[model samples]
Target chain A: MTRGSVVAAGTGLVLGLLALGPALAPGFTLAYDMVFVPHPVFDRETFGLAGMLPRHVPSDAVVTTLAQVAPADLVQKTILLAILVIACASAAALVPSERLTARLAGGVVYAWNPFVAERLLLGQWALLLGYAALPWVVRAAARGEPRRLVLALVPAAIGGFAAMAVSGLVVLVIGLHRPRPAGRSVGVGRSGVKRLPWSLGALLVMSLPWLVPSVARFSGVPADPAGVAAFAARADTPFGALGSLLLLGGGWNAETVPPGYGAAVTAVPWLCVVLLALVAYACRGRAAGTGGLGVAALAGLVLASLGAVMPGLLRWAIGLWPGFAVLRDGQQYVAPLAVVVAVGAGLVVDRVAGRRPELAALALLVPVALLPGLAWGAGGRLAAVRYPADWSRARAVVTAEPGDVLVLPWEAYRTYAWNGGRRVLDPLPRLLPGRVILNDAVRVGTGGRRDLRMAVEDPRARALDPLVRSGAPLTGALRARGVRYVAVDAPEEFAAWAGRLPGAERVVAGPDLVLYRIPGATRSRETPISQWPIAIAWFTTFAALVWSIRLPVGSLFALSSKEP
Target chain B: MRIAVAMLAGIVLALLTSFGVVRVITTSQQDPVVKPLYNYGTR
Candidate 1:
């Protein structure tokens, strides 16, 4: 294809995606349950508790208690905004002359990036919108305009601090690739400070959050050295050891690693390696061109590439992150790769452009030409649904009574578990003024397996279902602690437990769960954040489908593409 | 002329962005954490 033809095609593709994403993401979410739904962003439990329940955060932990308001449910909203930010950033990438080629290349690479697709679809807009600022910063660096750097970084300071940190690395690599001052020395320059990208300061700010908060979170709590050792042992696989550059392209994030910083770095090559090779061949005629620059960034990116996957280094880089003491897993380091991909994209495409005739057009068209970007978006939306146990079934069973306590077990007693509105007996009861919650760890035997150790046999610590035997101590604890509701995972022994109490009465039972009220215990309603509404929604939707009632086909909903 | 054009464009973009930002804050009234997620002292 002619250079201009490719450019036009790419731009057209971006425009097309810009329009389609908003409508498609939610639709896909409804259809083939996305993988992320169960796994969730941030705290999956919080998503269920706040969004499905009373739409609020409970004053439970020091972290949640510290919030003036619950952390903003930014996912669905983030997806909606991703469209706007992508469009705006795409426009920014098509900037002034002289640097127009690099900007076009950056835009082209960004449009097709899977990591960017993740941001667009997964509701990680806080991180995505942050990457949108990269192009302007690049343009400013290309022009050596300090004012532009300041202007570009101000938004990062307010909106995308983490994106700034991860993507900032890309800007540095690109700046190094820039045509420097004619007489510039190795380190020192006109003013004496190293000539670093001004955007780097803002990026430093972004990484600070990941680093600072993590450090503070762990500083007070000493590492379970055994836990860290187990994590290290688990890193035997390529996915575990974190050696692959491609793995970094997954959008790094974890309790242990920083976010998307690595994906941005690695993704640039996936889009450009072939094109870079083509450009290197295309540049056979050029005097001094981007082929060499591409090679340098490519090589540097590859060396740093392993850093994307080998998050073990991230364990050491803990010095740079928030929790210097406690090192988490590979997931957290994805941010660096994301930033790398974003900025590296600009350079890789720039290399391709520098060597080709009318190269700008090709770079512009690159992302649009890659059909996978669309599929990537769909894949992410469907990811949110992969897990089924996202919403706490136990939480949903309770009727919204303030002081009413129900006993439910968390251990693996697979069948008929999570009967409505039942709290487990020991720990929960221990917190109450007169209630005693029967806990496997405390009253019953610890360990997920069943064994009756508490009552000469707590029925936990050995059997497949620990809570099955927990019924005895649970009933006894419910009596002694004056608990009213026994929210057990509805099973055969529940009747036997209830029978032992003189005044026990059955209060509630669902298809899977059952609740019993003890005698002389005060009556109390269930919790508001209980899973009732979700249950109702499921039942209502199922019933409607059985009768073939028309389901709402919303335009605004996001959809996933099966083809991609 | 370029300065004026940039200024006008900036203002328009700012207004549009403000509208977008407002749309976000208005609709996303939810929490991102699970409750009793960790019974730390007890566990």
Candidate 2:
């Protein structure tokens, strides 16, 4: 590797260690959507055979496969650290400068910014993996080499459909700006064929693991329109919604903002940095070969701000086609803008060094200085914590029977006192051996106001909701639906919930968890959706990735033969 | 005149950045603690 490459990678590794802090320690870091168990079951749900939307489809499968080789805690740590290193290295490589300081400036800014901070705090590491893949994707697409593009897309493919969608958006925008040389007009033809070859088809094939299952069940599921309002971008700084987005700080969740991020004193300086980066990009971007990236960044910023600017339009679009619901979490599209800002920061340093070279050192330190909370695991908010002993007993008991397990409080997310009171998606589904069911309807809003956006994707969960709410004896109902075990993680609701299971046997009861075994609960006669299509889809994606790996190796072999 | 102006600008920039850094350190330590029965979709 070049000296610049080594420095950029080292910068990423250092920043990653700084950001992860105590999370890099022994235990699993359980935050929001991030859940890693000791042994994740590769069940029907892992392959999206269960009735709910397959949001975790191939990502869960990939982790489960990896956990087979290494401990899940180690796997999670490696993946999270790799995300930072790869993101910083790839973005630094994209700067059209040979100077090490210029590359360092780009890498530092890209890997350490508000967008990365908020996403990491929110525990959306899979999406962050795709964010890391983006600069590589742009580089590969600019070369118009199919193999390199496909190889660059491996991380997004493993990250599932949302990551693929975000990657596809930037690729589509960048593809639109490909130059037409010699007046041959390498743009869109009259016949409607894209001059930019292979990208669209490759994206589609890579997306099949999540796409096939989602499309198969698309008509059956209608996206909750309330989600548009719930997930719309909100300001995290003194700058209103649009201004916050331009600074890459308007993620929907207020709770996810870095410590002291919203205060005027801090926010003002961060805003200055953002404005300077934009000015630099506007002045020097085209000359530095970042014209296409600039356009993509602008397009991304516009999309990122759309929900905040026009929620009604977004709601209307989702109503027309549920597929448009992908646009609900607009803050995710700010990824390209983050890249633009980083490259712009690099340009600023490169230019300033021409005169007043000492000032370049300060510029190199500015991004980190402006946002110090991102260091040390977002102020120790993301420390690692082990699962409780009761949880393990509950998993073991449920797995011994190998029947369907239902999680109650009837809530999708839970907070264990042991896990530092942080809210995390229940690990029960992956921890146990069966089709573990939980509530899919997410509750939004704070304080007295509550909005339950009904996303009843799992048919079984939908069937049991009324029974669960009635607080009546559910022995007959559970038996009829073939729910062999009910895992209760709520301590407050323990007595009341356990009382409702009158005829069930208390298999394992603890303060943190209570598992009841319903005797005579036979497997439901309902036939499962055929797993053939999902399996075939996964196989094809894997096969294509394996085929794509050969191109680089073959090229190296050819080069060696010519040299001899 | 130009050197004095540059010095003044540098002092102000440094002061603001120092203030921002202090704020970031203070805020990073503060946890936006969620309630036991908190809304699943929010913080």
Candidate 3:
């Protein structure tokens, strides 16, 4: 490896260690959307054949596959650490300059920023995984090699729809505008015409794991129009939505902002850093071969800002086609903007280092300095914790019976006392052996007058909504719906609803989870959605990834490595 | 003149570092006090 490569890796390692300080301990880090169970079962849902839209399709499958080799906790920690390390190394490699300081500037800002902090805290590790792959995707697209582009997209593909969508946009924008060789014609030959289609085709093939199921089970997985307003980008900084997005800080969730991030004292300096990078990029980004990436970044920023600036248009689009609902959580599209800022920061440091080495050094430290809350596991909000033994027992009981398990309290997210009260999506859906049905509606906003309750996405969940809300006896209704087992994770909720279950048998009385069995409910067959298409997609992606594995693993990522 | 210039830069760097360190230390102590329901995150 080159000296610059080593330094870049070392920077990432240090930053990752600092950021994930407490989370790297013994157990799983159970934050919202980042639920890693001890042993994730590969059910029909793992392939997105379970009726719902399969948002977590192949990622869950990949984790389950990895768990077969290593403990899921270890796999989770490794993936999280790898996100930082790969992101840092990739961004460093993308810098146009050879100087270590310039590379460090890019590496640090790319790996350590408001976008990374907010997304990590929100527990969108899969999305961040795609973010990590984006710089490599940019590099591979520029090279116009089909195999390299496919290989670069593997991480994003594993990240599922949102990640693939973001990466696909970058690929499309960058691939369409390949730089012309000095004397070659601008729109002529194989370079200009054919390569973009190949890139798009690669993206489509990689996306098939989720895409096939989404296409197959279109009616079952509904995207709530209300989600556009609920998941819209909101201002986190004192600066309004546009400025917050410009600084990469306008995630919809206020709780996910790094500690003291929005305060003027720190935010002002961070804004200055972002603005400086933008200025630098404007002066010389195209010359540095970041052709069309600036446009991609701007487009991303505009998309992200639209949720805040123009929610009605987004809602209208989602109404027209449920697929457009992906635009709801617009902050995620800022992945490319984060890359642009990182590259721009590198340019700034590269340009000034000869005359002002101290300033260049300061630029390297500025991202970490301004966004200090990202360190030590987002101010210790994310700590490792173990699931209780009772959860396993409940899973065992439910698994032995191979039937539909319904998770209740009628809410998707939970805060278990065992999990240090950190809110997380119910793990029973993945932990249990059979089809587990849980609420998919997300309630947002502070519970004042204007609290927004999102429409339920799953048809099963939607069917249960009125039954649950009516507070009538649920045993007969649930049995009619073919629910064989009801797993209640919350204690108070179990107390309120347990009495209403007339003919049900209390199976496992939990320290953390409660499982009850409905005596004579007919078993619900798996959703008619076939797994063959998703399986084929997975196999094709796996084959392509295996086919692309020509370089030594280490050399594949090394900046100095040659294309073989 | 060069020595003076170097000393001035050193002071500025030290000052920035100190400011950052202090902010990080202070901010780290304030644990997230959001409501449990809002843990799903608020808009």
Candidate 4:
């Protein structure tokens, strides 16, 4: 890497750490599923990996292993910081410029944009990891070197399927740039066709871990209409959509917008668009790479406008396969566009700095000045908190009495005081381990729909709901299904239900959480599925990773042999 | 060959340095008593 790229990356890393500030002190942002709960990675029964694929498995495994050596919270924080650095470094590498100031400015914008800030607040670390690796994938594809291609897959493997998707898109864009041969008509498309095998092989190898499981257990569970709407891009006007994409600011949830944001914030996006246009005009035909990135940015914007522009089409495609739900949050498509804008802004900076060196400092300061709220956890939207001591004590109590525990007021998301007022996945299942049942309902939907009912159709979880609501006594029917302990976190909602547990002994009673032991509850029989697919996926991922490493090293040996 | 070696080495270095920096920063800082910005139940 050039010195300019190194400086840009270094500056971005320092700023990112500073931006996180006090949040990093906790070592964990207990905002969402990123709760500091450590567990074995391969528990298919508890995780329910039989019917679906979790793209975060590789990252989860890494964090789980890291927890053995360090505090899980610390490990989580480290991962977040690493992601930010990678994002900045990758963007810096993409800037085809010699100017240090311009490169630094680009890295800052790419790493600390509104899109990244919103996703971070939402606690989508896995997605962010994938987003961070995008520029590297683009860089590798542009070069089309075998060693570079292998290097690109490293991040794709670690980031999982989402990164693989982005990498695939980038590779396709690079392939489009393949020029026609000088004179031969037959060889016109031959080179591009020949390169197809390598490109496809790389994508398949990188995505094998997630792809194998998804294909093997292809549950065509369609997303709910409300979920699709809730996550859809909310840019009503054409200019508004373009501005939002440029600013990286089109999150569906209004709450995700910085607390004190006003009209001034809207101007920032427009300014970014204007700057990018001016840069494109100035550098027209001068930079071939910029043209490809511009095309990518335009494509990303169109994809992001899917539901917003044509709701019926988006919904229709989603109905064809549940996998299309990945596009539900079309706003995430802004990631590549953000990279393009960052690089364009850097080129603009480079041009201006060449004429007036004094203006370089001003260019570097533009990103910070424009998006100040994003710097400090999007105005506390991404604040970190330490889980209460009682949570750990409750986990121990549940662990001592070994049986399947059912969390009361059973819901997927919970707002915990311990998690800094952030709504997060109920940590009980991960904390206590062993078939801990919780409601996995998709409540965000219109009145009645089959697709929306998929997650909520858990008979076991659904059976407990009415019984708890009626404050009915726990009978043998409920006990046989393996709900041994009733863990109630929100007492106000379920106190009456807890009062109805017949012959139940209070294990760990606290203000925030209470655990009740069922007297006659027994362990439910578990039917284990064939583990061959999981084994194959894991084995293939490991082998591919090893082979990727060897490919580059082995090339050096080949070079030496040729020299001798 | 040298460029390829440097690229690989740089990746490893970046990964290690990031890990080390985060660990050191988080561990060295005093743990702050963070209060919930708003009531958790209201959300």
For this target, which candidate reaches the highest DockQ against the unseen true structure?
3
> Model 2, which residues run further than 4 Å from truth?
A180-197, A287-291, A356-358, A551-564, B1-32, B36-38, B41-43
Clash pairs detected, candidate 2: A259-B27
- The DockQ-based CAPRI class assigned to model 1 is incorrect
Tell the DockQ for candidate 3. Answer: 0.21
Report, for every candidate in turn, its global Cα lDDT versus the true structure. Answer: 0.34, 0.76, 0.79, 0.59
TM-scores, each model vs. reference = 0.43, 0.90, 0.92, 0.81
Error of 4 at A502 (Å): 3.4
A176 Cα displacement, candidate 3 (Å): 2.2
Q: What residue pairs are clashing in model 4? A: A27-A73
**Lowest-lDDT window of 10 residues in candidate 2 chain A?**
A555-564
Residue-wise lDDT of candidate 3 within A94-160, one digit each (tens)?
7777667787788889999999999999899989889987888877776666777788888898999
Best by lDDT: 3
- State how far residue A560 of model 3 sits from its true place (Å): 8.0
Residue-level lDDT of model 2, residues A235-277, one tens digit each, is: 8888898889988889987767876576787789878877887
The deviation in Å at residue A196 for candidate 1 is 8.4
Ordering by DockQ: 3, 2, 4, 1
Off by over 4 Å in 3: A178-190, A551-556, A560-564, B1-33, B36-39
